[model samples]
Target: MKNILITGASRGIGRATALLAADRGWSVAINYASDAAAARSAAREVEARGSRALTVQGDVTDEAAVAAMFDTALDGLGGLDGVVVNAGVVAPSLPLAEMSLERLQRVFDINVLGSYLTAREAARRMSTDRGGRGGAMVVVSSAAARLGSPNEYVDYAGAKAALDAMTIGLSKELGPRGIRVNAVRPGLIETDIHASGGQPDRAARLGAATPLGRAGSADEVAESIVWLLSDAAAYANGAILDITGGR
Candidate 1:
């Protein structure tokens, strides 16, 4: 069976992607920074779909933890066919000038550095030059990356923007090696992330602003992620897909 590792799989978009991928016959390594209970619950769902599942605990911002997570996943799954760098964070809405250095550091640490660590490890393990099979990587970016959440969370936006650049550059760098790198930019999705940003109802309030006139669900975004990881997207490297309902 094809194996995939997904960071932040305990809930939200990460959880949704794990469940969907498992349903489609992929062995999943569910990675969570904390809340082992939630991670195990996600693993149970994957196993219920008749797929192998492993629950791994690691803080993506910690280089050693990320390396260990990858090692555990590789050993448990036998091999990895894909990785989803989906773990991220956002502080309460605030202007750039008013934002504390610590807040910015925390955001960038998890969203930017964390993604770099996971993607780097995945490349190391999945690259043909490393004597392993090539695989796909799907990064969960945000529409805020392009919109530039002006007064809200510019730090979060900047972090995600960095991820976009990484997706483009890494896709080209790894294409010849048979690895595909892509990103999905989700907008106003109904997830707990907004609550972390101190706006639990942000999605509902902004739903009408989008052309589709509604906020997206975690499952909706998951579908796009799974497709990008599938053979159907064979020629979809370096693509930055928007799941924003035309926002």
Candidate 2:
């Protein structure tokens, strides 16, 4: 079975991807920042799906921790074929003038910088030069990147927008070496991320704005992620898949 590492697998879309990938027979390393219990529980679901599962703990923003997490995960799985950089945080909803530098940095640190750090390490380890299979890296971005969420959390949108730019560059840099890099921009997904931004009703409101007139489930986003890593997407590289229900 192919081995994949999914960051922030303790809850929300990351957890959903772990379950889906495992159910489809992919060995999963569920990385959690602080929720060991949740990670273990998710691991059980993976194991139940007849796939190997390992629970790892680390902060994606910390280079040393990220490095160790990937090392431990690869060691447990014997190899890695893919990585999903799904862990992120939303800055509190506020006007740009009211947003503190600390808040902006924190959001960028975890959402943009964290993905960069983790993806860099995953690329190094999973590169063919390391006697491993060339792997795919999927970043979970947000539609807010394009929507700009100016009235609420522009910082959050900017962070995701930066991620899109990173994926574009990384894809080109690594594509020649057989590594694929891509991103998923999900819109109005029913996830706890909104709650973290101090607006638990944001998703619902945004959903109503969508052409589909409903919020998407975490599993819906996970399905897109699973496909991007599958052989079915062999020709897909550096693709920015928008999962919005027709914005």
Candidate 3:
């Protein structure tokens, strides 16, 4: 079975992806930052699907912690086949002029730097040039990357935009080595992330304004992520897909 490690798999899209991937026959390593209980619950769901599941706890922004998470996943799952860089954070909505440096730093540190660390480690373990089997990687970006999210969390938008650039560049850089890199930009998905951003109903409110007329579920986004990691998308590389329901 293919082994996949997903960062921030304790909840939201990450949790949905873990369950779906396991149901599709992939051994999963569910990584979470602070919610050990949630991570274990997700792992139980994975195991309930008859696939191997492991819970790995670590702060994605910490270099040593990231390395340890990957190490534990590799040792537990036998080998790595794919990874979903899904860990990210956002602060309360504020205009650029009012945004604090601390908020920006925390956002970029977890979204940009964290993604870099996870993708780098995945490359080290999956690059054919390094004598390991090739693999796929999916970065969970946001539609804010393109829409710019002007007055609301522009810093988060900028960080996701960096991931888009990295997806394009890394895909080409690693293509020859048999690795595929892609990103999914989900818009106004119904998840607790909005609550953390101090807007518990943001998805429902903004989603009504979208072309689809409603908010998306975590499962909807998870479907796209898992498909990109599967062989069915063998020809899809360096693609930044928008799962915004036509928004």
TM-score for each model: 0.99, 0.97, 0.99
| Number of clashes recorded per candidate | 0, 0, 0
Candidate 3 residue-wise lDDT, 82-182, digit = tens: 99999999999999999888999999999999999999999888899997799899999999999999888899999999999999999999989989999
lDDT of 2 by residue, 1-247 (tens): 6899999999999999999998889999999999899999999999999999999999998999999999999899998999999999886789899988899889989998899999899878877776668978899999989989986889989999999999999999888777899999999889998898888998898799788998999999999999999888988899999999998
Candidate 2: lDDT over CA atoms? 0.91
Q: Lowest-lDDT window of 10 residues in candidate 3?
A: 123-132
Comparing 2 with 3 on lDDT, the higher-scoring candidate is 3
lDDT at 175 for candidate 1? 84
Candidate 2 weakest lDDT stretch, 10 residues: 123-132
RMSD of 1: 0.7
Q: Which regions of candidate 2 are displaced past 4 Å?
A: none
- Count clashing residue pairs in model 2: 0
**Cα lDDT of all candidates, in order?**
0.95, 0.91, 0.95
